[model samples]
Target: MNDITISNNPDRERFEVSVAGKVIGKAWYKAYDGDGQAERIFYHTVVNEEYAGQGLAGRLAKAALDETVAAGLGIVPVCPFIKSYITGHPEYEASTVAITPAHLQFLDKALAARA
Candidate 1:
């Protein structure tokens, strides 16, 4: 496995992926208060074009989601890539929350644009 380093840059509201100290990918999210609990809505994930097909996005997602769980925050995966990732990884299911209609609407537009 590659020595991919994942860190939450709360100052920037994103989780960054670095290899050899070079940033190559990031998963962005917005933090909100969900009924008195901290919640994170993952809106986007992007890996450098040159790093495509190397599964760095998956690594980023796993690290981000794990950190969210560790912090006791819920996850709302509005980003298609993140939704797909969590769907296929049952172990992370416990940390996920149901998407709201508003979030769904946003996701529809966001994902459609990507398609």
Candidate 2:
């Protein structure tokens, strides 16, 4: 198995994993600024079909969450995988913020604006 590399593409609002420069997985997120604070809401995470079962998703999750915490931003785990991942990882629990109606509204508007 080839070693995978993870990187954050802030413009795309995702943390991606690649094998020899070809992207194989991504964890998508959106940044919301409100209530005088900033948050990164992780909404989806995926790995290429052929890349499944290689632990790439977990890798992406770890890297993405780590970076979010390092950047001093709260994490709103809207994606089930991210929410579950945080559940088993106690270290990241401190930075997590539960999803609320305001977050949902913000996400709806942000996604709608893109469409």
Candidate 3:
């Protein structure tokens, strides 16, 4: 497996990872209102089908989360996969904002719009 390069594409508000010049996965996230703070992150992530099960997505998510933490911002995962990732990784828990009813409402509407 080639080394993966992860970068924040601020213009696109997403984290992009490429291997051998081909994008293998990406995690989308942005600062948004979280209960009371505006700097809370709402993250969404995806891995290219061909790259799935190879841990590329997790790497991309980790890299992105690292950046957010460095920026001194907290995260609220709008992506189910990210939520799951956070579940098994308690180290990142302190940076996470619990998903509340308001967040759930937003996510529901978002899923519906995409459907």
- From the highest TM-score down, the ranking of the candidates is 2, 1, 3
- On TM-score, the candidate that comes out on top is 2
| Best of the two (2, 3) by lDDT | 2
Query: Which portions of model 1 miss their true places by more than 4 Å?
Result: 1-3, 102-115
Question: Compared with the true structure, what per-residue lDDT tens digits does model 2 show for residues 1-115?
Answer: 5667999998998999999899989999999885878999999999999988978899899999999999999999999999999998989999999899999998899889988
Give per-residue CA lDDT, model 1, range 1-115, as digits (tens). Answer: 4677899999888999998889899998877666677788898999999999988999899999999989999999988899999999988788898888866566567558756
In lDDT terms, which candidate is top? 2
Per-residue accuracy of model 3 over 7-52 as CA lDDT, tens digit each: 9888777889999877777787655676566544455688888888
Off by over 4 Å in 2: none
Q: Per-residue error at 69 for model 2, in Å?
A: 0.6
The global C-alpha lDDT for each of the candidates, from Candidate 1 onward, is: 0.87, 0.92, 0.77
Candidate 1 least-lDDT 10 residues: 102-111
Worst 10 residues of 3 by lDDT: 35-44
RMSD of each: 4.3, 1.0, 2.8
